[model samples]
Target: MKKMILSALMLAGLVSCQQDFNPGTNGSSLTVRSGTSFGMCVGYCRQEVVIDNKNTVFTKTSREADKNPPVTCEKQTDSGTWNEIATKVNFDAFQKIPETLGCPDCADGGAEYVEIQLNDSRHRVTFEYNKTIPGFEDLVTAVRQQRNAFADCK
Candidate 1:
């Protein structure tokens, strides 16, 4: 009875933390990536920039010739401050970027990405488009500001 109880508790613990586990791939050291919005829109968009704990950066790109297909890649870079670059990208425009990329694999209309940094060591982005959180008028304003910024910049 004692052994069975101990095993059950251990199993429950593992199941609870499943989403928090990181089985480091290749030779990249692992770190906890947290999602925080600088200026959120009605929705979020994927950053497509994979920044790990070590601050190495990567972009999500496609090179089709068969065989290789689409894969998560890491770009070698010098260490620096981590932040979300696509934060200022317009909500609609940003949404289009991924729909063209490879988001169809996981979603029907697809989803947007969110930009987040880990430990301030790596600057990476993510796609964590949640259902439009109500009463976030500030998000709507920021999205408009971003859209205008892009148009005015050119």
Candidate 2:
């Protein structure tokens, strides 16, 4: 029964398209791949690509926002600069996106952060810094918010 349920979930994940996931944190370690591409956004249309432990998404705002926002950005900081991707979008294949974060015209530079989260909070977030990102922190917070949510993961 457990195997059957897991298979169904995998199929659903593939077909779902949203990539926004509500995965129970049960893996030995959560692997996060943060890669920025030039051509196109994978799975979903986003400027930056963030794949979470559950294959969830860390989506960005429109390319315009990255470019010239109605407001203004002086430097590449959290304020005017595009520091973090918005974490609200959920996985839905059918949902239509009016605009998307387009690819960079001339790919300048970006950073990829691969973080592994141990089930134990005591352990450093990753082997290196053991520090966590805002997105990962949101997941941990969500897990804790739910009553006995991580009971299964433990």
Candidate 3:
């Protein structure tokens, strides 16, 4: 009876540890992506940035591919920046936020989106461009800053 109780306690401990684990904290399986798009626009109508444990990639697409084509840039991600953004990630809170907030890109006002993937789970939120997300302000800001850093990619 004592042996069985000990085994049950050990199993409970293991389950609790798994419940508290957050992959974003270590960035081992964390990926963050953000982008902006314009429905009625010239030049590059869409811009995106993806950051993961290994690197950061920036891409821009033009509505008229023949006129401007597309641009892509990549570089190693800075550990400090990655940690700063990773620490701000609260997947539980993020999942509570609606996938689409307000009217995105209505009347060509533009739209922005942020997406996070950890292990096998992923979440994405889209809103009006330049609008703030209630619980994800800091993460969004960090992602936008990272995206802006590649403005000269083209």
Model 3, backbone clash pairs (residues 3+ apart or across chains), number: 0
Winning candidate number (TM-score): 3
Scored against the true structure, residue 78 in model 2 reaches a CA lDDT of 31
Once fitted onto the true fold, the runs of candidate 2 whose alpha carbons sit more than 4 angstroms away are 1-25, 37-53, 62-107, 120-154
After TM-score superposition, what is the CA distance of residue 106 in candidate 3 from its true location, in Å? 0.9
lDDT digits (tens) for residues 40-140 of candidate 3: 99999999999987799999999899999899999999988888888877776787789999999999999999998877888999999999689779999
lDDT of 2 by residue, 111-146 (tens): 223332323321112111112234355533332222
Candidate 1 lDDT trough over 10 residues, lowest sum: 81-90
Full-model lDDT, candidate 1 = 0.33
lDDT of 1 by residue, 1-154 (tens): 9999999999999876432212232224333222223232232222233334344332222233253333334433333222122222223232233322233225344343333222223322233333222332333233323333322211
RMSD value for candidate 3: 3.4
Each prediction's whole-model lDDT (CA) = 0.33, 0.31, 0.88
Preferred candidate (TM-score higher): 1 or 3: 3
**Which numbered prediction scores highest in lDDT against the true structure?**
3
Candidate 2 lDDT at 86 equals 22
TM-score of 1: 0.24
